[model samples]
Target chain A: MSLETGTGAASDPAAAPEEAAEADSLGDLSEFDVSSLAYGAVGTTVFLALWQAAALAVGRTYLLPSPIEVATAFVVELTAPTTFTVPFVGASLPATRLTANLLQSLLHYLPGLVVGSVLGIALGVGMGWSGRLDDALTPVTRFLRPIPPLAWIVFAIVWIGIGHGGAAFIVGIGAFWINFYNAYAGVEGVSTHLREVAASLGVDDDLTMIRKVVLPAATPSIATGIRTSIGQCWMIVVAAELFGAPGVGFQIINAAQNLATDVSVAYMAVISLVFLVSDGAFRRVERRVLAWRD
Target chain B: MAGLSEPSASEPRSDDAKVVVDGVGKVYESERQRVRALSGVDFTVDDGEFVCLVGPSGCGKTTLFRTIAGLEAATDGEIRLDGDPVTGPGTDRGMVFQEYGLFPWRTVRENVAFGLEEQGVPEPERSSRVGEMLGLVGLAEFADAYPKELSGGMKQRVGIARALAVDPEILLADEPFGSVDAQTRDMLHEELLRIWSETEKTVLFVTHDVEEAVKLSDRVVVMAADPGRVSEIVDVDLDRPRERTEPAFADYVDRIRTLIGE
Candidate 1:
């Protein structure tokens, strides 16, 4: 009986040469469609118009400041607080101001954003990579995750005093969990077959395999976490400032105490603007880092 | 599938006949029941031979491949590669699963170079070898493409190329073309044969298609479930570029079918 040994290119020289040619017919990589951009533009425009209309309807600036008043207040507060003057319908309205207060607010916001994000990412990656660690730490994480960031204010003030530390602590509490959950979920979501592929290829050790394979595979999820954490950071910034410190939240509270509703609404507008800018920056970074995902 | 004259009495044993599985059996325990995946599965694949294990679904073909690859432990009997027992997955044996297990995140070049990278091959050499393997699979242009972007057939080809790039002693494939369409499967079979002939790596391929087994194997080992065991070992005495409709091909197929009570 003859055997089909398979090692016979030299012995039999005339198989289908066309198959190799046909392999070349595959198409080039295509780009994402522009339809998504159209959808996004339409959604954003509708949201902005609705927000402006709602503010106008509320009328009592303190309860809900109109968009135009907030814009005018923001312009006046931002320009040369040394000689700040508000412009309203071709008339100037002099107002009380504090530029140093903006800097104080930023001090709290920046530290909380950086510290909370770093710790959260590290904790999440650690928990994700080790099942033992996950078992040991999950209860603590779940217990803490459900508690609101503001709930930590009492402890923050008791431990670190009632200024920047307390506010930063609250902000960190808010940002930390968003990043932690995302990173953990990302690592857990890594494909089993991909891990097997790595193992079968001689990357049998967990550490090396994680560094080489799991880390990159889980990056998209981690990136999502970072983006979400940025939004959370902004949300907590005002809340943290509201607790004490002299940021935008404190300014809003002060305006309310003085019964100046328009000024309070103006600060809220600034917060929204800051959030939009931060979101834009994050979107740019996401595009560059995840370019390979396409 | 035309038959050839039998080897002469003085004919020397081909160099490819090196893999020896002597009375191998595997029994897996699942909670409360014992499933026999293979029993007395004996076969010898020459050093560079291409053997296909063909059987119906739930048969022990896949179990045998896994056992040989050292991915699954055998319950009874031994499998010797060259002359050593396979303890675990090593560089000596490369495997290709039916699902192209390419990392979706990595580029085509990276997936092909994964094993080499694990071996700690230098960067320059790794890059060159990756390029060469990609070329071999006719995917050189897609070196930077992600796995998600490739067609099913293309992904499987990369899987095969990745397995081969490591220069393993044997390739254990578990229904490697099972996920693709009929046309793609036929194309892959041809491409596989071409690669096998060129590289001369010992291959133990698993498949449920009778015609595929006849076309690709020097020896088609038929298997059955329900206390899984080797039903028949049919020597495919057909020449290269096999024609499926030939009488000898039908005879070999009939023999296997009869042995399996099909």
Candidate 2:
């Protein structure tokens, strides 16, 4: 999801209070399963029917790939032997729609994510724990924070070429700041009383205190950073592909450039699927990690 | 000044007495002002003695404890643990904070073992000692549980267990039961007394609660807060399992409160 869509999706339950004062806050929206299901079913049907009717009126399959045509394209992609050439790894092996493309994206995304998160957490926590260091670093971070991740595309390309290196660099840049801010906030937000308690316990050394007390207390915020980075990494994957990498982003860009609208939409769907499935999986992991929070 | 003995570290003492604070005073100086937190505070405790420093807020009861624990420097007095000056905090001085400052990420067992581990105790002995302390604090079931999962009282139990695991010569508790509710505080008081009886560690507990001091302490030292001076020292002499509603309890609490006011 784009940032706005992610935010909007987040705000649906949050904004119901504004939409209707009398709405049931506690009552489940899915309480009446039949009605809710029917509402969704009817909405989908009406939307597709209207879209089909509009396509027919336009009388051009190229301009408005019919829903049926798009479905056929999706099936074709599902059955097709999706293969690509890698400079280092010979001809890519045959794999399923779920495995080949998805795993390829993960191969690139995971390394960048791990590296970026580790660095960000270390830097953020370091600055947060020390007054002198934080003061020295604030101006530099502030100066760099406003420059968008895409703005770093030129540097990323120069530093790491146009393959996994470049894409990972771009993805890392996208994810780094979110975690940096979150980890910084986490350390700064630790309760003073808690620090005093640690001091009284004879664990007054800075590193020991942070590792033992501050980090645990600030976990909820750190989890937020991780979640935010997950979303950003997915976004940058697409952007990275646009810059000539072998992820879904590159697939989408390649299809769009060729004016293969059906293929473009199919790749878009793939991107959405990757984001949704990965987000859900990460959410499960995050809940388990922060089980101590609540 | 009648019952208050003058500064005399050279005075004869039995082998049973373990800690002596003679002519101790604390002066905090800043760019704008100077505050003398304590003055000529002389006290001594026998091993296994339960002494409570009772006072109003900011009375420096906490400062006195910190000084005794070697966590703070006393400007003009000497604190001797078994006739040795307190240079710094050591394994012998175990401290329990009111906030139940057990490491949130650590299991109860790990937190209890922190002090022993710091002292470089071997793993087998550390684990056994930690187990023993957890049992002493009635937290054996919570050995694997994290502090966040435990209630306020249970967290304090972990804190108590952590201090006890070190096998300290003395336990310095700064309002250790202040954060818990009345019922839990009462329960913990009983638990603490039992632990104190069993382990025989000298305890210097500081609290603003008059009745708590009277309930747990063998002697209650009340202090007044403005510049923080010792007001009076009352010998509780009440038996174990103190009766809060008893006339003597009420009388002691009222007397201490009034002394603090004056």
For model 2 the local lDDT of residue A17 reads: 49
TM-score of chain B of each: 0.91, 0.92
- By summed lDDT, the worst window of 10 consecutive residues in model 2 chain A runs over A19-28
Candidate 2 wrongly placed segments (more than 4 Å)? A1-69, A84-87, A96-104, A191-211, A214-218, B1-17, B22-36, B67-78, B84-88
User: How many steric overlaps are in each model, in order?
Assistant: 9, 1
CAPRI band for model 1: acceptable
Off by over 4 Å in 1: A1-60, A82-106, B1-17
Task: Using DockQ, give the best candidate's number.
Answer: 1
Please give the TM-score that candidate 1 achieves against the real structure.
0.82
Model 1 chain A is weakest, by summed lDDT over 10 consecutive residues, at A23-32
- Model 2 TM-score? 0.82
Candidate 1 structure quality by residue, lDDT tens digits, B26-88 = 888899998777888776777677778888878878778878877778889888888787777
